[model samples]
Target: METQKINVAAILVVALTGIIVTVLAASLLMAYQRVPNYGYVKSVGVGVYWDQACTENVTSIDWGILEPGSNRTQVIWIKNTGNTQVVLNMTTGNWTTPEAENYISLTWNREGQILNANQSISATLTLSVSTTITETDIVEFSFDMIITGTEQES
Candidate 1:
């Protein structure tokens, strides 16, 4: 009976220590700061809209406050306004600061997706900033997100 009591005490001590270590690790992980950035949005061959109706154009993307090594996603609609089927292509250019282009990247869920004429598709746009961006030279930047669509010839 006494041996069992000692074993129980040892297990309880180990569990309590483990819980304390876990709580401390979580607290440390949550003690980081967030960085902020912003950029402009534009479209070319296709319409980037906030609504499926394609009336509310997505003029800009506010990444808001961000953390290093973190990614932000925005959902928008792309409309094929041309008369023929088109494959959507997205590109970024005209960055306000050259360093911004090197540290920040833009991507979409759909790559080389074909859209029928007058059809709209919801797309998730992701903006990622490198965790190695230690340089404080850039707090904000602007860029043109040209979402061009290539016409598929029959």
Candidate 2:
């Protein structure tokens, strides 16, 4: 009777070991299942572009032989040669001749505007000389025009 009991205990241990090994093998196989990756992810690139001419600091307006009581209108062409729309802002530096400030007046048609891709806009600058200006007064003015562009949100 003792031999029969020992044999039954050994059989139970072997069965339990086999069950644990089979469960482990099944789990590993499932964890490493081979699946085809039919989908792929690609990255898109984005950038900002600006016109070459607009980026330069070259003079766009030149009024030669400015006379007293004369009004001159010069157009500065702002072009957007980029792939995205942009908001443009213009900044003017202080006049070179402070004495001429009162006698000379400056005005712009549009100081701020929106420019679309591959589009151009004109900014008319009107310079007026007051009648009080004398011939020998020699009113000389120089300033900078800075054009800044910011990309528009979609």
Candidate 3:
């Protein structure tokens, strides 16, 4: 009879421990399920817009005629369309014609500069042909200007 009582007490203790462990696990799960809301929207915005004659669909600049020993300049405006400030990096690709590449010179005023939100910067591009270009030589060529913007660091 004493042994039977001891067995029943041990069983009750085991049952109590199981119930405590289950309750603790359930409480922990409930705590994790409730997510705190800070009411803040998270986003990272980086964008730029070119105000040149070329649009998103059209990417070309026309220099009427390529004359030897002459320089042609075009002004392009860049605007920051993002919510934050950014620094721009500009680069140009190779000319379409390999033969005219050496004779043609391209330059921009603003290569690496900082711009604020909704701010505008004017970049002047000068295309000059060397005097060595002859009348017999074909000088029609085109190049690409790539502008990239990076978020400013704090």
> lDDT scores for all predictions?
0.86, 0.68, 0.71
Q: Give the alpha carbon lDDT tens digit for every residue of 1-154 in model 2.
A: 9999999999999999999999999988884557777864432212222333455434446777788899998766667656677777665567787677778777777655677777776677788888888844555777665666677777
Report RMSD for candidate 3: 5.5
Which candidate model has the greater TM-score, 2 or 3?
3
| Candidate 3 local lDDT, 1-154, one digit each (tens) | 9999999999999999999999999988884456777764423333333454324322567788977999999877777667667787766677677677678877777666887876766778888888887844655877776776677786
Deviation from truth (RMSD, Å), model 1: 24.1
Models 1 onward score TM values of 0.68, 0.49, 0.62
TM-score of 3: 0.62
List where candidate 3 sits over 4 angstroms from the true fold: 1-25, 28-58, 135-138
Q: Evaluated with lDDT, which candidate comes out highest?
A: 1
Candidate that scores best on TM-score: 1
Residue-level lDDT of model 1, residues 1-154, one tens digit each, is 9999999999999999999999999988886778998974433367889998899999888889877788999999999876778888899999989788888899998789998878999999999988877666777878999898987666
Relative to the true structure, candidate 2 has a C-alpha RMSD (angstroms) of 9.8
User: How many Å off is the CA of 106 in candidate 3?
Assistant: 1.9
Clashing pairs in 3: none
Better of 1 and 2 by lDDT: 1
Listing every candidate in turn, what is its Cα RMSD in Å to the true structure after a full C-alpha superposition?
24.1, 9.8, 5.5
